[model samples]
Target: MGNLYLARHCKTAWNLEHRIQGRTDIPLCEIGIEEAKMNVGFLEALKISKIYSSPLTRGRQTATIYATALEVPYETRDGLLEMDMGEWEGKTALELSALKPSLYLQWIEDPRNVPLVPGSKEDVFTAQRRILSTILAIYKENDEEKNVLVIIHKYICSLLRCALQGLELNHFKKEIIETTLPQNLSIVSSQVIEKCLSNC
Candidate 1:
């Protein structure tokens, strides 16, 4: 198995506003730039075989910052794209919650049943699983990679948990995303493949 580093994008203006930025491309905030800079150690230590990232601005910015340390071209993978929230793109979670409380609740409690937003073409849950499958395929293909860094968004990050832990397919809380990261970008670190699934 290839080693994986599933990283959350650095914060953006929307992130600080507590607004939902599901799939709305936004640049990293200044603090996010600093945070991304601090991740240099993790990057240096990873000795990553290759760096992959979602195409969104936040993800791209984060990858570029990391690439400075890697001295390698960051590979953009659409497979790692963020979940498309459609009508809910720029609203805060609370704001959108008010607009679609029932849908919002279902999204959090169990995303599989969360209906597609009015104009979005894909279901959040389905998209997540598809992204995860793409990631797993990357993991499988990179048989010689010592470390594989996968830059993604919050929702897709939760999906990775399902892939690694066999969790029920659901939209799970932001904690799934937050906890995956350390307070300072330490979450979902570079772990040895053997150590990650020792029991297997």
Candidate 2:
């Protein structure tokens, strides 16, 4: 019954440029740093005691901001990493839509059916499984009252949101997850809960 708060990392250069950054390992941009700093007040309100972050620099850096503000320990977890975009790693969502309209539509409308790479299978299931397993382990390790923070990326966030909603991966588009810089969510017993967006 512990509180789990999931946050998407702050903005990045790739983010500013409208690029899809799945597993690209890009660092936070200046705006990203400022955004992370701004998240301190929001996280402070949540009273988080510990943070778990994706190993990627963006997630790590964002996690540091909240952990420092809350005076808590933070650890990086590979299981929290972003989804692998394969050939689409560096392309913008707009670019994908323009270059491969049908594929892009499939990605947006039914992500589980379309491969990130043109010819490969979609890895949504794998990403969801890895992230869920890690979140569950963390939930098990902590007491029910502790408020835990998890910093991660957009695609991974989508998968996590889907898992929390008790929906299949293909239904990801049905719910809107806040993916803007430093978006927040709450979890209890590993179940994701949608709270008021203004409060998050």
Candidate 3:
């Protein structure tokens, strides 16, 4: 199987403040830029042939640094956008828990059911199966030993991991993924995960 690297986007204002960026279009904060630079190391090692990113600013900026380092122009793909958090765009965790209690509870209980903000839900990679189809299509059309990086959101990265491993989605939690992925920079690939699992 070919190698695919799914890297979470760098920090954002919301990321720093613990807000749910969802499909929000906020630029990266100061720390996010440094984090992006550090994370670009692994990607540069891969010698990525083509880079793809969410059309949103955060995602694009995250990948652009890597693209510049790799001397390749990054490509934007709408399919790879982060999930739309709707009203939760820039609300902090504490704020949401306190102010939008019921909605927040529902969101924590189940994200799919929450009413999405306009022009947000349509751009999400919510399910693993859907992402698999999209990624596989990209692979099928561009067959080669190419390494690619898709800079996306934190949760979407987990969902893609779930899809690659065929893990159950509902029972899947984001915290588990947080601990598993590299702290500032992480690499996600079907082959790498499989090898790690096999060794385990």
Candidate 4:
């Protein structure tokens, strides 16, 4: 019954510009690097045994910092990758709203019902399933470990939060979880993971 610490990657240049970074492989900015370094103290207290990260650069960079600081091993997993935004990859929310109002509105109001954007690989529901399965697998693999760290993107974090709260994907925006996580680290207790697996 290991605990999973899900962390959002630090800021990036695109993050500063408010761009959608889905599968874009953007690196962390100076501030992001500093933020990761700053977080090491708190992470160290958790005594994480190992790290799993998304293959994207941002997630990798954050994981590297934590791994180096905590002296723990880290590996990248494709299943932990960000949702593919396709044509919407580099656009900001405001830009998307202006360019495709109906689709953007659907995304905001009910992500589960939003049509896949042109060139998008998976819709919100698909992304949710992928993340949930990935997390469950990781939890099972590290059952003996006391704590495990997983570095991922904001969208995936939001999806996991929705699932952990026993809410549907459509509740993403409507719930208190918000579209963005409050901080870098989110603690997913083993009990909650067990509950999620039963319902999954």
Candidate 5:
């Protein structure tokens, strides 16, 4: 029964431009590095036993900062990777709306039902199952850890949050996406994981 500290990676240049960064290997911007440093104190107080991160540069960079500050070991996992956005990788929301209004509107109305992009390998439901399984595996493996930090991308974090709260995938855009901002942490308790699994 451990606490999972789920955090989104700090901002990248693409984040400022409001570009979709799904599966893109963008490094952290200067401000993103500083933001990670600033948030160290809060995370340090959690006494994190270990840190897990997405393999993406941004996620790894943020986890490295916290791991160094907290003096904890850290590792990366592929399951924590951002959803593959395919053709939408570098486009901004406005551009997507302009270029593919129907696709964009379909996503906005029902994210779970639509393909992330034309060539993407995983849908929202697939991503959700991957993240949840990864998290449950981590929890089971590190039973002794009082607090474990998991740094991942914004969309991945939102998906995990939505699942942990026992909400359906359709609730992701309306309930979780906007609120799951970068550098923000969401606490997931053992009981919450149990509840999530039971619901599944």
Candidate 6:
């Protein structure tokens, strides 16, 4: 079993604009670069052994800073990819509400039960399954004492945290807001995740 430190990629230009960047390959803005650098201090004492990230540019960029600084092996994992928001990918909340108020409200109230788009849109449960499997597989590959760093997006991070805490996917909204707030980094032991999965 390994310990994992999960981080959401830092801010982007779209993030600054309050946009939904799901599955869009936007790079980190200048503020995002600085934000990731700031996290370096927080990670200085963690002694992370390996780094994994979403294949997206923002996640890759943020992970690169830490991987280079700590001299750890870094790789991109497809399972870490952000949710595919479909038609809503580049739209802001305000825009989405204006376009489809009822749908937007439904999403805000219960994202796990609502579909953002008609077809081919990624839902919370699907993404959670992918991310949970990825983390579990990674956990099985490492020793109990190893510390693994994984970076992805805010929504995925929230779902992963819910799983680690043995919470249902529906509880994701009740959990702390990881995207717009601090404490975007979460640490969970591999054993806890395994137990959570076994009980399920």
RMSD of each: 5.3, 5.4, 5.8, 3.2, 2.8, 2.8
Error of 4 at 39 (Å): 0.9
Query: What's the count of clashing pairs in each model shown?
Result: 4, 0, 1, 0, 0, 1
User: Which 10 residues in a row give candidate 5 its minimum summed lDDT?
Assistant: 176-185
What is the clash count of model 5? 0
Off by over 4 Å in 4: 174-200
Query: How do all models score by TM-score?
Result: 0.80, 0.85, 0.74, 0.86, 0.87, 0.86
> Per-residue lDDT tens digits of candidate 2, residues 15-123?
8998878778899999989888877876777778788998999988888877787899999998898877777778877778777455766877767667455633446
lDDT of 1 by residue, 93-151 (tens): 77666763457666766676664765678776567556756665666666554567777
What lDDT would candidate 5 get against the real structure? 0.77
Q: Number of clashing pairs, model 2?
A: 0
TM-score of 6: 0.86
Candidate 6 lDDT over 178-199, as tens digits, reads: 5422242344555666676665
- Write down the RMSD of candidate 6 (Cα, Å): 2.8
Q: Write down the TM-score for model 2.
A: 0.85
lDDT agreement of model 2 with the native: 0.73
Question: What are the Cα lDDT values of the candidates?
Answer: 0.68, 0.73, 0.62, 0.77, 0.77, 0.75
Best by TM-score: 5
CA shift of 163, model 6, Å:
2.3
lDDT (Cα, tens digit) per residue for candidate 4, span 2-21: 56677788889999998988
TM-score of 1: 0.80
lDDT per residue (tens digit) for residues 100-121 in model 3: 3466655554444453434455
